[model samples]
Target: MKFRMAKKSDLKEIVRLLADDELGSKREKYEDPLPEAYYNAFSAIENQGGNQILLVIKDEIIIGCLQLTIIPGLARLGIKRAQIEGVRVDQNYRGQKIGEALFREAITIAKSEGCGLVQLTTDKERKDVFRFYEKLGFTSTHEGMKLILN
Candidate 1:
């Protein structure tokens, strides 16, 4: 598998991987022509200095993806942290350790960026994933909250 920063052309495949999940299908709309909002959002991240969408490819097809963002904060003594989000592995490729590989790559990038820590959030209902994350050395030590504004 090859890990690389995603190109605009990979957006649709990445969305396919994301929406293949039970929970993601509720939030992501993966269609023949993906909504302009996805493209617009991709462009925004592509232009940011500390943000990137990473793709895992095998045999010239995208099999997994995740977005990594380096956030510099004053709360942690001005340390930089890596936030991993939107992780997904293609349904056909699950159970093959592709997700694990993606996480490993993200951590490697975080270290190169001088990040002090790496963190990610998953829905509590995703019971199957909690163990996988824990196996990867993650701990459930903090409560995560979110607000929706329209």
Candidate 2:
């Protein structure tokens, strides 16, 4: 598998991967006519510094993708940390350690950016993903909560 930074044209494939799963299918729209909001959001991410969308390709096809955002904060002794989001691997490629490779690359990128930590939040419904993360050495040190608006 080849991992690289995602381009604007890769958004469709990325969205497909995001929507392929059970939870994502309900939250993400993978329709014939793609939404303008997706492009708008992609553009926003592209224009932002310290933010990256990564794609994992095999045989010239996109099979996995994730987003990493490096945040500078006053906490952790003024350290910068990388927040990982939207991690997805194609269903056909599951249990092959592709997700592990994605996280390794993210960690490499984060360290290169001088980040001291990498963090992410997964839905409570994703028990398997929780175990996967734990196997990756992530500890459940804090409770994550979110409030949706609109």
Candidate 3:
């Protein structure tokens, strides 16, 4: 598998991956336009120097995608932190460690970009997934809540 920065052209495949429930359920109204928004958001992020979107390809097919966003702040450590979002691996490719590989690559990218820490949020009900992230070196450090616009 090869990993590279995502381009606008990869939106369709990325959306398909994100649409898969194995990945996670998407936001209601935004679900239909997610592909376009993902591309636009990624473009905006890269342009702003706070985001990096990557795609994992195998056999010329996009198997996974992730967005890493850097948060600049004046905190205890002077290091910028990264937030991982829109992470999804194709259903057919699930058990192959592609997700882990993608995450590892994202972390490498974050570190190279000078981010002090990396973070991501998964649904609390996903117990197995929480374990997986912990195994990959992420800690449960904070609580998160969201009120999606209806």
Among all candidates shown, the one with the greatest TM-score: 2
Give all TM-scores, in the order shown. Answer: 0.97, 0.98, 0.85
Q: How many clashes (backbone N, Cα, C below 3 Å) per candidate?
A: 0, 0, 0
Global CA lDDT computed for model 3: 0.80
Residue 34's lDDT within candidate 3 is 61
TM-score of 3: 0.85
Q: What TM-score number comes out for model 1?
A: 0.97
Q: Which 10-residue window in model 2 sums to the lowest lDDT?
A: 29-38
Local distance difference test values of all predictions, in order: 0.93, 0.94, 0.80
Q: Order the candidates by lDDT, highest first.
A: 2, 1, 3
- The sequence of per-residue lDDT tens digits that candidate 1 reaches over residues 1-150 is 999999998888988988998899999999989999999999999899999999999999999999999999997789899999999998899999999999999999999999999999999889999999999999998999999895
